[model samples]
Target: MRRPDPVSRALTQVGELFALALDTLRAIPKRPFPAKDLLEQFWFVTSVSWIPAMLVAIPFGAVIALQLGTLTVQVGAQSFTGAASVLAVVQQAAPIVTTLVIAGAGGAAICADLGARTIRDEIDAMKVIGISPVQALVVPRVLACVFSAVLLNGLVSVVGVLGGYFFNVIVQGGTPGAYLASFTALAQFSDLVVGEVKALIFGFLAGVVAAYRGLGTKPGPKGVGDSVNQSVVVTFLLLFFVNFVATTLYLQLVPGKAA
Candidate 1:
C-alpha cells in the first residue's frame, strides 16, 4: 500500500483528533461518570500549574502596565493607565498566559502520562478487558483540563492586575488612587466573560491534542518524548490561531472604548 503524503497524513490525523474529541464529549454524560478521576486530574492539573502561571502572569502584567502607562503619560492621560492595563489583562493577556502554562505544562504532563501508558501497553490491556479508554481516560482528562484552565484564568487575571497595579503605582509614579480609580472607567463585565470563554475553549483543545498525541504515540520511550513535544507544539499553534480569531470576534461582539 502506498503511504499517504505528508499533507494528507496531517489532515487525516486532525480528523482523527476531532473525532476523538467528539467521542470524549459524548462520553461525558454517560452513566458511571468517573467523578473521582475527574476531580483528581482537575486538582492535579490546576495545582501543578498555578505557580508557573503566576510567574508568567506577573511579568506579563508588569510589562503591559509599564508600556501602556508610559504611553498614557506621554499623552497626558496617565490616569487612564489602570483602565488600559486592567482591560489588557482581562481581555487578552490573562487567557493567553494561562493557556501558555496549560499547553506547555499541563499538556506535557497529560501527554507524558498517556504516552507512558501506551508504551507500556496499559492502554491495550484496558481495551482487552472490554473497557473503552475514551470513557475511562479521555473524558475525565478533557473535563479536568477545561476546569483547570478556567480556574487558572481567574488566578492569572488577579495576579496580573496586582502586578500591573504595583508597577504602575510604585515604579511608574502613578498615584495608587489613579490606578485603582480608572479600572472601572473602561472595563465591562463582558470582558471577563469573554476571557473565561477563551480559556475554556483553549483548555478543551489542548487536552484533546495532548491525549491524541499521547495515545497514538509510536512504540518505545523516545516515541513518548516525541509525542509530548508534538503535543505542546501543536497545541501552541492551535492556541495562537484560536486566540486571534476569538479576540477579533470578541472585539466585534462587545465593542469597548479605548482607555
Candidate 2:
C-alpha cells in the first residue's frame, strides 16, 4: 500500500490531537476528579517553572524598557516610556514567557512521564482495568499547567514591570512619578484582562499538546525523547499563532485608553 503524503499525515495528527483534547475536556466534569493528581502535578509544574520564568522575565523586561526608552527620548515622548514598556511586558512578554517556561519545563516532564508509561505498557494496563488514561493522567497534568501558567503570568508581569521600572528610572534617569503616571494615563484595565486570558488559553494549549504527544508515544525510549521535543516545538508554534490572533481581535474590538 502507498504511504500517506506529508500533508495527509500532518492532518491526521492534527485530528488525533483535537480528539484527545475533546476527550480530556469531557472527562473533566465527570465524577472521581483527580484532585490528588492535580495537586501533585500543580506543585511539580510550579516548582520546575517559577524561578526560570522570573529570571527570564527580568532580562526580557529590561531589554524592552531600554529599547523603548531610547526610542522615546529620540522622539521627545520620553514620558510614555513606562507606559509602552510596561504595557508591552504585561500584554505580550509575560504570557509568552510563562507559556515558554511551562512548555519547556513542565510540559516536557509531562510528555516524558506519559511516554515512559506508554513504553512500559502502564497506559494499556489502565485501559484494560477500565481506567481512562485521560482522566487519571492527562486531565490532572493539563489543569496543573493551566493553574501554573496563570499564576506565573502574574508573577512574571510583576517582576517584569519592576525590572522595567528599575532600568528606566535608575539607568535612564527617568522620573519615577512620570513613569508611574504614564502607565495610568495610557493603559486600560482591559489590557491586563487580555494578558491573563492569553495565559489561560496558552496554558490549556500547552497541556493538551503535551498530553496528546505523550499519549501517542511510539513505544521506545527514543520515541519518548522525540515526543517531548515535538510537544515543545508544536506548543511554541501554536502559542505564537494564537497570541497573534487574540491580540488582533482585542485591538479591533476593544477601544484603547485615551491618552
Assess the local accuracy of residue 56 in candidate 2 as a C-alpha lDDT between 0 and 100.
99
- Tens digits of per-residue lDDT, candidate 1, 1-259, equal 9999999999999899999999998989997899999999998888889999999999999999999998998899988899989989987899888887987887899999999999899999999998989999988988989999999999999999999999988898899988887887778899899999999999999999999999999999899999999999999899989999999988787778555
- Candidate 2, residues 1-259: lDDT per residue as tens digits? 9999999999999999989989988999998999999999999999999999999999999999999999999999988998999999999999999999999999999999999999999999999999999999999999999999999999999999999999999999999999999999999999998999999999999999999999899977899999999999999999999999999999999988888
lDDT of each: 0.91, 0.96
Query: Deviation in angstroms for 55 in model 2?
Result: 0.1
CA deviation > 4 Å runs, candidate 2 = none
User: Which clashing pairs does model 1 show?
Assistant: none
Clashes of each: 0, 0
